[model samples]
Target: MLIKGFLDALQPEPILSVSQWADQNRLLDSKSSAMPGKYRTSITPFLKEIMDHLGEYSPVEEVIVMKGAQLGVTEAGINWIGYTIDVSPCPMLFVEPTKEVVELVSKTRIQPMLESSPSLAHKVKPPKSRDSGNTLTKKEFPGGILRLAGANSAAGLRNMPVKRLMLDEVDAYPVDLDTEGNPIDLAKKRTSTFAKRKIFILSTPVTKGLSVIEPLFESTDQRYFFLPCPHCGALQHLKWENLKYQYNKSSKVAKEVYYQCEHCQEGIQESEKTKMLESGVWIPTKPENQNKKRVGYHINSLYSPLGWKSWEDLAIEYEEAIGDVPKMKTFYNTSLGLTYEESGDKPQWEALYDRREDYPRGKIPTDEIAFLTAGVDIQKDRIELEIVGWCEGKVSYSIDYRVLMGFVAGDGSAQVWQKLDAVLNETWIRPDGTQMSIRMMCVDSGNWSSEVYAFCGRYPPSRVVPIKGRDNQITIISAPKAVNVTRKNKSVDGVKVWHVGVSLLKSELYGWLRVNPGDPGYCHFPMYDEAYFKGLTSEELITTKNKNGHTVQRWVKKFTRNEPLDIRNYARAAAHMVGMDSFSPKHWELMRNKRTGAVKNKVKKKSDFWN
Candidate 1:
């Protein structure tokens, strides 16, 4: 044993890169990784250089990454933490957005990481009841300690001095922690004591102006991964615009999904992605800042490896997210790794009136009409409803609007509801002689709550949706909630009401109303009178201070008759509930075929009757 120990001591210690160290020692836990076993950097070759730059030997002090989801960036961070523990031990701090997220990552990610690799497990001991060194938020090794923190906690940011700092999902962090100022600024102060400190900031960006990572990313030498096209050998980075797809007519999947080379316009299949990635290289866009001791990297989900998020799935997701603002925002931040820009200005109603189409008010215009939805607005003396035809890409046509004048509340409300039932049940004729029925109808419960609920409850929940509008809701439409109503001194059960985000819907509608006729999400209107246009443009969005003294946007009526705007948002809510938000091109094609086939069969039946 002494002879062996002497021989081992005589051998020189080996220097290892972070990627090499992770490949040799790290094991991906099944609990966290899709493929659980020995970790291999070759699977995602784009991450190798990023991981190596984070190694102890590299001179780079700070690394900023603005990345999309499912790209193994977070796993690279875990590898860095594991490498520090197993190889170059130092005081390290990892910060998530909140305490709850820190707890979740510690339990699901950090703990499993330690247990998966023997080298990491040996250095960072498991927590026990009596062990203070190894706990949920902290881990101690031979030469250093690892601490987990939350950006929301001021105490966590000020707890200790750390040489290695990692801020994950920094965009989700609050602007100020307990009014102590920026959490990132506070966390950076902890590393001032160490000259060779390393800082890594990573996030999927949020809004353009409100993003925390975009400005930080702009400060460093920005690096992007470029791959050579297999067909034409042209080197270029993958872009959302370059990805093309054609949906299958019979199936709900893409018939063809390919990347068009930016240089040669050659088609590249997904199977060639592996070789392209293996040969990919990162080039700094700001080469002048290469020696600044800081580096930044940006990549989107298009670079995700094969079997992880395919190009087809991204195309379909983008297609479905085209018209909905919230869904588009999520796709941009999570799939494109970019911030979403919001347009809050209202569109002028005069433009809409002048560009109105000449289609008939009560008939479907063309095969473009995939379905129909109606929105009902209840007033004291009458009920106003608008029927809207929805097409692919959420292009909508204002088909018809009717007012039933009567007592819509208290005594004679039953007759008004009966009139509404007839309008809802009417079949509208398409230009091709195909018949279309109202798929769904949303009745506003804001004016006469009990009466609206009673009218809506008469039909199936799918046919008639009762909705109450709420300001500043996070989502456009929420799931329906069952409420009890009292009738004749007895409580009735099972009336579902959905809460609608009027503010968000109005924002989306006004944006679409501004689009030209040929563009996606453009609104087409029939020949309505001047008063109709006035009511449609009745409310204008105004910025004002709320009770908390914070700036907020509110819709205030410029005209007394705002039923057109109210009923339009209700129609949008009906469309949203009936899957308009997620319908792809194939879905529209199927509906079109169904209507055409039905019309042909009806003609054949009439011909056979004459024969």
Candidate 2:
């Protein structure tokens, strides 16, 4: 009690805005900070009001910043830290998405802030000092402790009591930390100890309805940073829809992109950004914001500091992101400060089953079929495999799906694998008596990897590949990487492990399943049985709310057995191995003629009576 009284007495009586404090003491280090000079609010003048209102004297209890990248959002938070530490000393908790981020901010932002500011540097001594209170994740000051914790660690957010809470990149945080409920709510519990506590939630909005920041923004008075029009002087928020650009041939635009005036329809030159930004004002759209305890602000990349990322830069990024939904979604979230919504079109198993063609299983390839690839799924009791046919436009047909029953011996020899070997090279007769073999086969190396490697090694490298699944958003099938194995002629005969992004492939497969049979990239199945369809559609793509209030898609199996899906993915991966993705019509024509040409030549000649 005495310590609290003494600390309160020691605190500077005069109120100082975070922006003002930053201008006076914040020095941008050339090594780490983007701007290497004394901090100036004039640069990101739009954020100054936010910083000032967040000061100790302000009535605001929470500030939510839903902003685009490079708009000084992080800098604003840093400024608040500077204010809380230097002006009004108090215990603070800074939460990032992960421990890595906590360490990152500590190294890049917090450390630099202390080293650069003389006032802060004096109080928070360098690590070299004997009594140095500063560490990697925690900083100790005279009257307050700045604890840096990751949202991933529930204990970090729950145990500590703090007057100020800063949650950075809240959208990146998981929905639950170690299953202790929402990290935001857990962190909020710590602030109840201090009546004058301040909470700052800042993030680039992620998925619509799934985003953490958007709901908070809606609950508050949604304020937009309004800039005066250079021509008409009409106040307006910068929106992406108002921006205009022209695309030239080659699908790449070298032309300029500019923001058009909504009031006067005039082209607002990028040069006018400074004058406009200086005159910018945040106008709250909701009436509840007048209460002053909670405030929300949203900004976009268009308002990025002059000479930084320009409208033209954003235009180029948009051009590059064409046809790529994820890339484009990232741009919208980070640059436009918007949420992306998935199509929510989940394909039904019965629908796919109903669409199965009359193509007889393992009999003949249709005219649509070009080449065949195989995928092998290893199990303790049986080996399941699928032969998939590929043609122009990524059209796929399931040629055969079978289960070879046998157990692998300790010596790596298995009757199932022998059965696999027979079928792996066996020819499938096309409609015109043409012969086709599995061009490339990818065997799952996840289970019994040693045997899989040994089995794959038995075949030609080009014909057989060991595959494993990867958890990544971008790649469907990555290039071969090293696996756990030892072999002679390691350079030439080493077992290659292909990494397949199962989630990405599943997403694509489901999307294709939604497509009509005649459509491009449509997937076709033979009338094998109901179980096959069940395996194909065993997994459902579930979109759940992440910690950041953003929606992320994950494949959750409805049933235990998803071998059909796994083997299909493997066949698709094998198809990639045989250059199915970018295969030209000419290439397909040559491949289509290969088997028929061989059959024609054999039929034209008579077989010898004696071998």
Q: Largest lDDT belongs to which candidate? A: 1
In model 2, which range of ten residues has the least summed lDDT? Answer: 601-610
Per-residue alpha-carbon lDDT of candidate 2 for residues 160-208, written as tens digits (9 for 90 to 100): 6889999998877777678778889999889998999899999998766
Poorest stretch of ten by lDDT in candidate 1: 601-610
In candidate 1, clashing pairs total 0
Give the clashing pairs for model 1: none
lDDT of each: 0.83, 0.79
Q: Which clashing pairs does model 2 show?
A: 171-548, 174-547, 175-547, 210-549, 210-550, 211-549, 212-548, 212-549
Model 2: runs farther than 4 Å from truth? 1-13, 249-251, 288-290, 348-509, 512-611
Task: Give the residue spans of candidate 1 off by over 4 A.
Answer: 1-12, 132-135, 231-234, 249-252, 353-507, 515-580, 583-611
Per-prediction TM-score, please? 0.67, 0.71
In lDDT terms, how accurate is model 2? 0.79
- Model 2 RMSD in Å is 9.2
Candidate 2 shows a clash count of: 8
lDDT by residue for model 1 over 1-611, one digit each (tens)? 99999999999787688899989999887798889999999999999988988887888889999999889999899999989988899999999987888989989888899988988777776687366488778889989999999898999999889999999999878775787878999999999999899998999987665577887888778889999999888789888999989975336577589999999998999999999999999988988767657999999999999899999899877876766687888799899999776555656778777988898889888878888889999989898999999887788999999999889876656787779878865888888777888888899988777777766766677788789997645467876788877665644457799999886677778788877777778888999987888888787777666443333456788878889988999999999888877676778878765663221111101111101
